[model samples]
Target: MLADGGSRGLLRKTFGELGLLSLSAFLFAFSFPSFISVDGLWPLVFIALIPIVPVIHRCSWAAAPFYGAFYGFLSYAVFNYWLTTFHPLAIFIVPVIYAVYFLILFPALKAVDLFFPRYAYWIQAVVWVGYEYLRTQGFLGYPYGNLGYALYKVLPLIQISELTGVWGVSFLIALIGFFLGHALLFTFEYDASFFVSLKVWFSRRKAALAVCSVLLVGTLIFGFVVMRGSYDDQRPWKVALIQHNADTWKGGLPTYRRNLRTMIALSDRALAADEPEAVIWSETAFVPGVDWHSRYRTDSERYALVEELRNYLADKSVPFILGNDDGQKADPGLPPVLSDGRLNRVDYNAVLLYENGKLRQTYRKTHLVPFTEHFPYKKLFPGFYQLLVDHNYHFWEKGTEYTVFETDNGVHFSTPICFEDVFGYLSRRFVRNGADVIVNLTNDSWSGSVAAQMQHMGMAVFRAVELRRSVIRSSNSGMTCTINPDGRLTGMLEPFAEDYYIGSVPIYAERNTLYYHWGDWFPLVMLSLGLVLLLVGGVRKIVLRKS
Candidate 1:
């Protein structure tokens, strides 16, 4: 009877702890993009992980990984719910892969607690940032939900990204979560006078508090100073962003023609009103590939379609940057054929610039999306590659160079197609290559989710702030807008709306951001520090065991 009672008690306690962990996961999800419309609720991110911290601290090392994985799976499943819109399988696969990150993180935190007991909170925070840095690396490095993105609307707080990238902001947020969690743990668990417990916790963690305060204050001061600095030499380039709310998937050729006509009519109206320097179109704005402009020049029907577009551009007398599939004849030296057994040609998702009916520049999309766009490690697994091919899944070959285009007026810009703009380093490379502005051409009609579009825009805003460059994003279905150097949205078009916006984007010639010069160095340093600590901890444990 006594043994049964003890087992039941232990089971009840375990369930209670799991409940707290679940609450933390829920709060963490709610603090991110989709769940909360109000950006002011971002402060909830600081305390969201507090509940899980206690669970992690109290659980045995063997159990910590499971708890962390469960927490991560639940949190990510909720935060990235839009992934299901792409495929139902994503709900299972993505969370399972993402949970491995937390599984590793929790054990590292336990090691920190065991090795550096006095500064466990600080070490835990470092480990958190280190894990986040790791998440942004390797074959499947996705830089989503980095906590800093929650503060996108808080312009002043995010200017620090210029110096430290998103990792620094994530480090600050993790530090606050650690501090709050530690304080809460002391308040609840300490079996002393409440005030005494408070004083003891404060004394023990004063160094962490001091460091966090300095970083927070310094970041804000730096932000304000940068914001106050005048852009007296800044030149405004008026741009017309066209969003033709087209259902590219279900839409046949007739629908495509109608959408194209609508976009052309809208562009004409916008040009008549403002006469912008250049007009931009979303990804794959038309059906015909750039190759058809020359490849099918002999075919009257195909040639006429290409001629119609060229004539329109010539009539407008304005330069245009638009998306198209540009193709090149495959090298005969290459061995393996495509799934269709045709290796005659290779196609690229490219952005082409046209001035007075002549193609001036073509920038192919690099950093293709994994699996769906370009399968990683396919050479090693030929069977899996064949399987994908059997399913009729066609992937675009990755582009090699960072291509930047210059307008006749001497304005320089780079077009990063689709979610390529989400990568800070890729955008930084363009800025380094003398791109004054980023023109992103994307087609977001597939997901058909407003939250997904807004979430993507939220991340893209950071790219503008990180490099102190303007970003003009034109999407097929939504989020067509101009973002200034300060991350402010201007002339934003409504989601799923057939609309066009004309706005002036400030061109900053100076590209001296620390992030641009030294990409992601802060996170790399943190990751290195974490590795050193783990090595030291492992050495100490081995020495003690031998002794």
Candidate 2:
């Protein structure tokens, strides 16, 4: 007992819980997009959470939640450093929310570890995935830092997203970290080297190792096979995506006119090619409401600009698609705000499609970026809400529909405006409802960070795989590209450059993927199974104590 105490003391002295927590936080920070670079040290993610496990395993139950909270806040504070550019207060809000998340999460994890000692690691991994799923739901759904995204460049491994909606990949990686964490914990307890401890640990855990290996190998083989699976129902498709290189933040008729001219110039260049079916512009590319100005004509300058754009589209042979505000009569609800005078029109972040010089279809963005685009707690947090408004943050009315658009040429697609593509379920819903392709129109220029742009672009890879539909991201100021059904990126335009990419996109009329059919089932199942196991563990503990 005295020797055991000495060993444990030495372990704590050599690497304290705070030290391990800081190590994990730094690893977690660098594992995603940070100031380091766009394509971060992604390889570190495989073992990123390994150090945290010992901190989790050894900490007193009272200390577990605080340690977890600190880890969460520190990790995200570093990873989401770019959020400071989004808004000064954003950095605090995001990390504090994560801190609160882990405050609750770690205690539950510690409980499971205490009760289900043998299967704790596996169950904890499942819980981690469940946490991710829960976090990315409803108004606060932010999908950055998801473990699966680190594997965006590893095409073969991430093909599992088509099966499990990125949650499966999270589970696999988390499980690997748990196994490695256990080995590290052994070394710490025994004062032995990691390699010797890992070898000893591996011999005792052959069954778990085999299962994990089989899963890893199986997914790789599946990926290779899926990559080879040709889309037999594909058709010849061509679309032009324009990057006007204009700052989306700039306003007034002067900035709008300059942007419009830049786009028209870029469009002319694209139109010079074999007649493309459609030309796409980034989200909110045209700041003025085309619909409102064309009819209201209340502001002659804005109205004339809208007419100029309409005339340009009318003269073109191809369908014109661009993001603009769609103003409709307001029947607004939560986060109440004033409508435009007696016009009473509430504007939505919307995409408009022009066919034969007439407006053919419109897809209003359903998923709004949480505080920046749509805030719901106006009455409850009026002062804070006004502060957001004071910070030059404007809000839009949320459009409540999964709108699929069809062109005059018989092609069908959905424009998931901006970060809507980050949510797999939204893309799945679009595919299930007959969107042949996913064209994400985005204005990432406001962030003014290429690392931020790359991080945003990376998530689109999974959306393509999950639905087996092609994803074409058209962004203002960066990352205009098409991701094929197999999660391959091609025909990319230079970021922040005045350029355009005309891709001969292959329209895959392939059947929807498993992820589309059963959307987010893996995470749901893991959450449900976790609750059941925890309940069972509680009952067993009670029975054992009584006996």
Candidate 3:
């Protein structure tokens, strides 16, 4: 399999280009919150894609996909460096998926640049938004690194999220990136001094100005007006969010016992400080499967622990919400168990609501973390599934329904377990289905990275504005906080710390939020527009060639 001299030369050139482009991605990665600075170097975002533009424009159609994948992997790998902490395999797996995505995107960017040089950047922005929409769909959808997430603190700019979800903000930001990127390309095209090329770029700014100005000004105007309106805490319900600071990866009776005690201590202190209407605990705050152990009594020790939890729940005056493993027997009609003569049982990562000393309702997590949490389709991806299984990955069966919980005082809400809050559609659905607030129960203590925690919380901010629903994030060990409808995060507790937050979570007056009714129409529109432009470009190219 040794390559000849010519092939080796090509390989060397390719690796050299890849190494160079990764430096650009690294520069852009600092635009998001990280160890570089918690409040990211936001100004860099406007020019982050400057280096990417020239490559796509110069590369041939045959070479575009390869470069696209190269860009995807490097950009994501640097931005999501925390994936390595999650699992050694995750850093590669997550970015490689993006690589496959950019294979389509990169070629299209090049094709559009070749055919329609004048409006290439504008169309490219639309295409980028479309790609983000595609990436955040299906089982593999992780809406973490979208351009909109970087501007979480920029209230005026992100106000567009109400009408267009995060897609609109992404489109605006991406357009800016492309506009600035094209300016750098202009310098090379002119073969002139940098200052002279800069002046020329500014003079020919009609397209970018026309699009960016109207959106930018209108966004700020809307934001200021909206911000001025008082968000009345008229329908307020106090909730105590408990962060026990537990390492979720560690399992067994000892760890479980310690985490539970910490949660109780925090909850008691919160109750003492303020009489919260209810208490919220992070995901898997209790490790033992409550329903399964109480019913079947699989292990005597775990069963005893479940009994203790039941007694604690019974004594609580107000409703208590916590995350646990909800286990049930698998159907005989399903595929044979991976177990060798073991109990044919399936477990769900679920949030349970207890009132009057009884389990009232349960919401099983719908969106599972791809390979780590749930990996089905064994026949199609046998090797990958086996690889995951070999790594000791325990998969959970996907839950089909969205469950809404109601407290004794008639406070209606839904708990979107863990990363579920990061997805816009889930929060919209919860609000649509009569959930007054969105409460997220998450356990991210295992990552051991504050940057990772901040990244997760940053994405959740958009869900609040998109649906106009108050969002409460209660996590084990960090990022426990509440977000208002206007996207202002309040009471954001320290990451990876044992703490509790009691907040007056608002229940907005039931009114039709535009995004809730429209769903993901904005992104769909962008995707359609991108397809149409590419189709037009193909037709134009063929017509010109034939003539």
lDDT winner among the candidates? 2
lDDT of 3 by residue, 1-547 (tens): 3568889978776776676567668767888887797777777776777677888876667888988888888888888888787788999998898889888888888887887798888899998899999999887998887888888888877877888998888888888888777888899799789989988887898766776788778888988887776578458888999988887548678989888888888988999999999999989899898998887787899899899889988988899999998888787554324346676688899999999889999999989988999877789999989999998786887888888899989899999998888889888888888898899999888777787788888888888888877889999977899988878987878877788989886788466567888988998999999999999999999999999
**Superposing all C-alpha atoms, what RMSD in Å does each candidate have to the true structure?**
2.9, 3.4, 3.4
Report residue 347 deviation for candidate 1 (angstroms).
1.9
lDDT of candidate 2 over 1-547, digit per residue (tens): 9999999996775468879888888887787766786777888888998997777788887888888799889888888888887888899999998999889888878878788777777988988888888999988999998998878878999998988988998899888887788777878876568778778878888998899899899999999998998754579578899999887557678999999999998899888865788899999899889988776676789889999999988877688889998876565442223444455568899999988899888888898988888899999999989989998887988888898899878888999999999999899888888889999999888777787888888899999888888899999887899889888987788888998888866788656678887899999999898888888888999999999
Q: How many steric overlaps does candidate 2 have?
A: 0
Q: Ten residues in a row with the worst lDDT in model 3?
A: 332-341
lDDT of each: 0.81, 0.85, 0.84
lDDT of 3: 0.84
Angstrom error at residue 535, model 1:
1.2
Top-down lDDT ranking: 2, 3, 1
- The estimated TM-scores of all candidates read 0.92, 0.94, 0.94
Judge candidate 2 at residue 122 and give its lDDT.
91
On a 0 to 100 scale, what is the lDDT of residue 513 in model 3? 64
Mark the regions of model 3 whose C-alpha exceeds 4 Å error after superposition.
1-20, 332-341
